[model samples]
Structures are given as structure tokens and as C-alpha cells.
Target: MKWIRKIAGMQSSILGINERNLGFIYPNNARKNYKYADDKYLTKNILHSHQIACPLTYAMIDAIGKIEQAWQATCEWNELVIKPSKGAGGKGIMILKKKNDQWFSQSKPVSEQDIFTHIANIIFGIYSFGDSDVALIEEYIRPHDIFYQIFPEGVPDIRVILLKGVPLMGMLRMPTSRSDGKANLHQGGLGIGIDMKTGRLKEAYDGEKHITCHPDTKHPITGLTLPHWDEIIRMSLKAAMKFPLHYLGVDLVIDQRKGPMVMELNVRPGLGIQLANREGLKDAIYRAKQENLLN
Candidate 1:
């Protein structure tokens, strides 16, 4: 076991060395917060200003406001997502769906008071980096039904990795037992590699190795071609182009009627995308440059 661990560590070091040498042409920063930290607020403000089509922001309640009033004001949206403005990895977030004149949190029945308490908890940063400072109430879009069938009970979204404002790779994240119904791959969800140009699932991998069947569903995660692949890639490039950083990942979700919406951006995206795609990311970015897409 020790030998195996030692060999794995040595291999990782070798990869890290290769990645660093490649950094001259392909930029990467592992220490800084990227789109996930700044993109949500920036996206909310920018998209709202240009009317580029986004989830409607019904309300933004700080931790110290009239929680009940905000809850009442948001009751009519029918379906909505209550998310901490600064939360990451799908923590401190709640989904409210209206059923027969009542709203339920993540499908559990709840009342107006229940929502107030929940939002208040968000303000307290129950699932955030710090105290829940503020929360956003936005339209809860019903994802395309076909994708929903794959994720079941949760929202399965896409993550496109971009370098120098060009889309290089993409993946479809499916909710699994590890992710607790969230599509984030690092949180234990499944990451199925996407073809750079086609957006089709080519291979699937959990955190460790290649996988054909979901750890929980026993269903294969491959063969599902994502809808609106071209548009999703374009949106990712457009969003990344707006930032000063050269490398980033864009999280996008396609709605049933509204098309693709930018969910958030991540500056320091996870590198597991390489394993999911069955290739080294360093090679993909190099290809992107050779084709002169970065300029």
C-alpha cells in the first residue's frame, strides 16, 4: 500500500511538472478565486443590465432585513432558487417549488414562515464560506426534461473549460449520491467528458477512475449528447472574454424555454476535467493555441 501511494504521489508530481512547463503558453492559477467568487455578482449585474436573458432576480435579502416581507414578496414566483450570494459547491442553497398554492423546499412541504426561516439561515451563512451575508431569490428554471431524466430530482448542469477566452473542453455533470443531488463533480457527482466541438459525452469518470455506470443509479453516464452545444460554447467564450484572467471555467444550465443561461463562472476550475475527458488538459490547450483560437 505504501509503495502504491508513493508511486501515485510521484506520478502526480510528474504531471505537475509537465503542467508547469506548459504554463508558459497556457496560463493557470491554483490559488486565486475565479468566476465562482466574482462571476455570480458580476453576471447578475451585467446580464440584468443588458437583458441578455437570465434567471429573474426577484429579491436580494441581506442577513439583517425583514425576512417575512421578503418571503411574501417572493411567493408569487411559483418556482425559485434561494441561494447564498457567496456560496460555492451548492452549499447553503434551497430550491422552492410551488405545488397547489404552497411552496416546498427541495420538494419538502413548507410555509411562508418556513421560507423566512430558511432565508434567514442563508443570511447566517449556514452553508456559505462565512455567515450568510445576503441571499438571492431567482426564478427556478425547469431544466430540459431529457436531461432531467438523467439527473432525476436534481439539476444537472454543464461545465465548459476555456483558455484565453476560447472554449476548449466541456462536461455534463450529473447528480449522484456523492454530490447529494448537486451536479458539482468535486462534491462526488459524476463527470462525463464532453467533446470539445460536439458537446457529446465521450467518457465518464468518478473522482478516481473511469466509470460506465453511475455509482448510485447503476445507469451508464455516457452517450448523452448535450443540447445546444454550440451555443453553450459560445456563451462560455463570451463570458470568459469579458474577464482579465486568461483561464477559467463557465457553468451553464439550459432551461426548457429560455435556452442556455450562465449559472456562474469559476476562475480556478478543478482539473478533474482531464480525467473525465480521457486526455490531458495541457494537451488540449496546446491544440487550441496551435489552431490560433486564443488570439
Candidate 2:
């Protein structure tokens, strides 16, 4: 009921799917330049060119013949993340750790051939709607300590929405037991609103209802402080300005050692953020425009 009360006055300002596409996405993001954001390898290249921090690429394999050699270069690393460059919804991603010269995923032993097979599957585009894709062997991020106590299983991230290089709203995504360690809100994870100016936490929306504590860890949700808040916004806007897209959703993760690193960029970001923040994008967009007019 409190959550309901919080959003009571914002009903008229909600941004729905249709309005989002026609008003924000289609007009601002060009189809030809979507590759800069849609392809993981290409996104990293853009981030690298602008000196924006992101996960390090160990290798990129586009052909079946090069899979073995590319993966070999990453052998010295204790942990690695393999994913499809054009994958979506967290599909085509594999994380493995090494022990005794063996790789294990989710604590289950997997053979070297199994790793090769997964990489080959990525190259064949099994995850990108049947289009050929590249395999990205990159750095595995261990989230910072602040996230460890919240939920230890998956890597949580922050989503910042920006338009014309101006940041508007922000949300923190955290994993829940039901989400199977995936921080996607639709997959049963939690999306908590953020006080963009103060970097303070607010109520969390778990798809159905508003909750103040983590369902899995029993940790408090509101008023939680996020570390490196400035860096996250700065990098998000940096990438936004650097890209051709005017409207954007910049995703970022706080690495245990590296601080905030850009994870991905989205030209057509979701609207679930309104429920998380108990606010509407319409109002945010208007406010940003007003501010821009004055300055």
C-alpha cells in the first residue's frame, strides 16, 4: 500500500511501450548504428576507443577454425567469461573457474571439450536468433563488497537512462533466488529505484509488489549506499555522448578491484524502471528538457 501511495500522483506521466518507441527510441537511435550497441565486441571497441572502462576482452573468435587458438590465449587466467557478441536476455553466456587444470561451472565439472563446444555454439549464432555471431572471451567480474552482502550468487548491475547525453533516471538491479542468479527484472530479480543526485537507494519492485528487503538474503533494500556513484554516471554519460544514439540505457557494474565498469549499452531500454522508481519517464523527460532550456 505504501508503494501504491508513492506512485499515486504519477499515473498521468507514465511512459508506455508505444510512446517509448515513437518518442524516444526510433527517432533518436538510427538502425544503421545499432551495431555499436547490439554487438558486445563492437561495444567494447567503442568503449575502448573513448577510454571508458569495461571488461577486458581476452579473445574474440568469429570462425570455428580459430576457436581453439583464441581460447588458449586465455588459459593462464583463473576465471573467464564466454559469451556471444550479439546475444540478448543473458543468453549464450558461460562462466567457469579452474581447479586442478579442470573447469567447473556452477560447481559441476565440465571438460575442455565442453568449453570448446560452447564457444563453437556461440560462433554459429545459436543465441542470436540464428544469425552468425562472434564469441567474446572476456574478464570475469567479481562484484564489489557492497553487493556481496546483498546477494552472493549473481552479479548485480545499475541501469542509467539518458537522453541527448543528459542522465535522467537510475535503477539498481539485484539477483534473487528465484532469478537463478540473473539480475534481469523480468526473470524474477529485483529493481530498486535510486536517488540520482544523492546515490541513495529506494524501494525495490519485484515485478508484483514493492518490498524493502531482499527476498533471499533478508537484507534491507532502502537507504543502501552505492559506492563509486559518480564514476558510474560519468562513464555512462561519456559513453552516451560518444555514441551516435541520443537516447540510451547505459548498464554498469562495480568490479571488486576495478570500481565501476561499463557492462553494456542499450538503445531501446525497458520501461520497467518506472515501477522501480515509483516515478514516470514522462516527467523526467520534461524536467530534463526544462533544465536544458534554461542552460
Q: Please list the residue runs of candidate 2 whose C-alpha ends up more than 4 Å from where it truly belongs after superposition.
A: 1-10, 293-295
Write the residue-wise lDDT of candidate 1 on 90-178 in tens digits: 87678888888977775679887777777888788776666446778888877887676665767788888776677777878877756
Clashing pairs in 2: none
Expressed as tens digits, the lDDT of each residue in 106-221 for candidate 2 is 66899889999999998888999999999998899999998898888778999999988888899999988898788887778898999998889999999778899999888897
Cα deviation of 185, candidate 2, in Å: 1.6
Name the lDDT of candidate 1: 0.71
Off by over 4 Å in 1: 1-39, 215-220
In candidate 2, position 189 carries an lDDT of: 82
Native-to-model Cα distance after best TM-score fit, residue 195 in candidate 2, in Å: 0.8
TM-score of each: 0.84, 0.94
Top-lDDT candidate index = 2
lDDT of 2 at 84: 95
Per TM-score, the best of the predicted structures is 2
